[model samples]
Target: MASPAIHIPHGPARSAHLLQRTTAEWRERGEDLLLFAYGSLIWRPEFEYAEALPARVLGYHRALRMRSSVNRGSTHQPGLVLALLPGGSCRGLVYRVPRAIGEEALPQLWAREMPNGVYDPRWLHCDTPSGRLRALAFTLSRRSPNWTGPLHEPELLHIFRHAEGRYGTTLDYLLRTVQGLREHGIRDMELERQAHLAARHGLCAPP
Candidate 1:
């Protein structure tokens, strides 16, 4: 099942102003724009933009399920994966790139982060220090059989335990998320507990 595209209704009147300001800034600077990354990109700067700003987006969720069967790594060494799920929320950083540069950057980022067709890109509204703005985000592909499911800690650990790629292992992805959560002062008990458990079991080591 291909993930269906979502069209978020335009926000309040102020939302239009916010988006216009952001788009104008990018246009003026000739920059590509911002992308909201809640997965490996948070930790692996090399995969995408050079500069990232800590930001959040409302009305979205993040999970660790494969959207497509196009596996990233060798059969013996799988790669870290991300799947968009329903009825939960996510927090992550927003990265900025030059508009011209993003044309080249997005495909590379997608290749590294989304090796399979499991994930698809979409436009989302993000909250930043300045205000609400638009950003590009990746979500589970509607075509994925694994779409819209609950992704618990144990399931995520199982995937990470066997993951290996050019950048690092699945553990690296988990640990970086832990650090990011702390840095942002996010108070999600479930995520905190999961990170601790993954560390205790040696699936991931605390930094």
Candidate 2:
């Protein structure tokens, strides 16, 4: 069954406050912080990292479930973005942020990822080649108003075709993410299928 349409609200101020409080606590403890990148972060981390490694998380999978209004689309013509939805599993990368720069880097990270508090920031266990590790991940809530629910391929193609946001076109975002995954030898079947569908419609991949 398809999930119903959602109306997303803007709340950057509230989101920022919550993130500030959370990150401050992390900094006071002086703990090593690791970040899990599943989608855009893979290609656009926009932060300095000490190291990154391929990792996998259980019990949750990546899905095109969030509606992007600022980065990949507008309010009137919303496009889809990836979210960590419940069920299955996901393979991505884990980034280690040096404790020395954690204070300065976290606020900047929050500003980029938590534009409207659409995602619920979480700490989840990921299995890396080195060992089991806990990393901060942005997860999506089904109850959130930003949830797009389950969308069909035609709907995905349509959204990818015409949606353009502050960052770039929706198609470009998808293409880059797929390319990024391939670079790490990770293959997300669903995203790959969607990319194939978009290509069938004659959408050119970004050079």
Candidate 3:
């Protein structure tokens, strides 16, 4: 399987443009919410938001920090998972919510995704094109064994390849994350290597 061509809706310049627009809207509306996306949420279309922007976080890394016990062969299912590992930097998208509606909107967002103990939401400082901002993001549960032990890329990919959810399969998640990384002008050599291995070994979904 060949690696998918990552589609960036607009060029890197547009990222700054979007940031300005989002910041202006937030200021005008007095919003107090920020969303940091590190996984499928970064590119999944169904999980759409009113204002989306390109953002980054320093001093943190992206990994398969979470695990799902509920397997989805090709559909959405409910259950819990584990949050594993730490160390490294992760790059993804961030969203801002208006202060007046943030509280009301966050619950809906949480309900849609974090129905069970599958995800642990936390506040992390994110670096954006505009500047630094605190955003809400989800990480895997710390209770799982994978959280404390060494993880192999192939194994994680295998797990994600079979996992399914309301939006799509785990392979879809991996593809979208790779695309999002390219869109944000972020690069991880490890991720690139893992992706290549997946492609070389025919680990991705069928085209």
lDDT of each: 0.58, 0.82, 0.54
Q: Which is the better candidate, 1 or 2, if ranked by lDDT?
A: 2
- lDDT against true structure, model 3: 0.54
Error of 3 at 80 (Å): 12
Best candidate (score: lDDT): 2
Candidate 2 similarity to native, TM-score: 0.90
Stretches of candidate 2 exceeding 4 Å from the true structure: 1-10, 205-207
Pairs clashing in candidate 2? none
lDDT, candidate 2, residue 105? Answer: 79
Best candidate (score: TM-score):
2
**TM per candidate:** 0.67, 0.90, 0.64
**What TM-score should be assigned to candidate 1?**
0.67
Q: lDDT score, residue 150, model 3?
A: 50
Please give, for residues 147-181, the per-residue lDDT of candidate 1 as tens digits: 63556666666665666655556556556666766
Tens digit of per-residue lDDT, candidate 2, span 106-128 = 88888777787787777788999
What does each candidate score in C-alpha RMSD? 8.5, 4.8, 12.3
Model 1 regions more than 4 Å off: 1-31, 47-51, 67-80, 141-143, 146-148, 151-160, 202-207
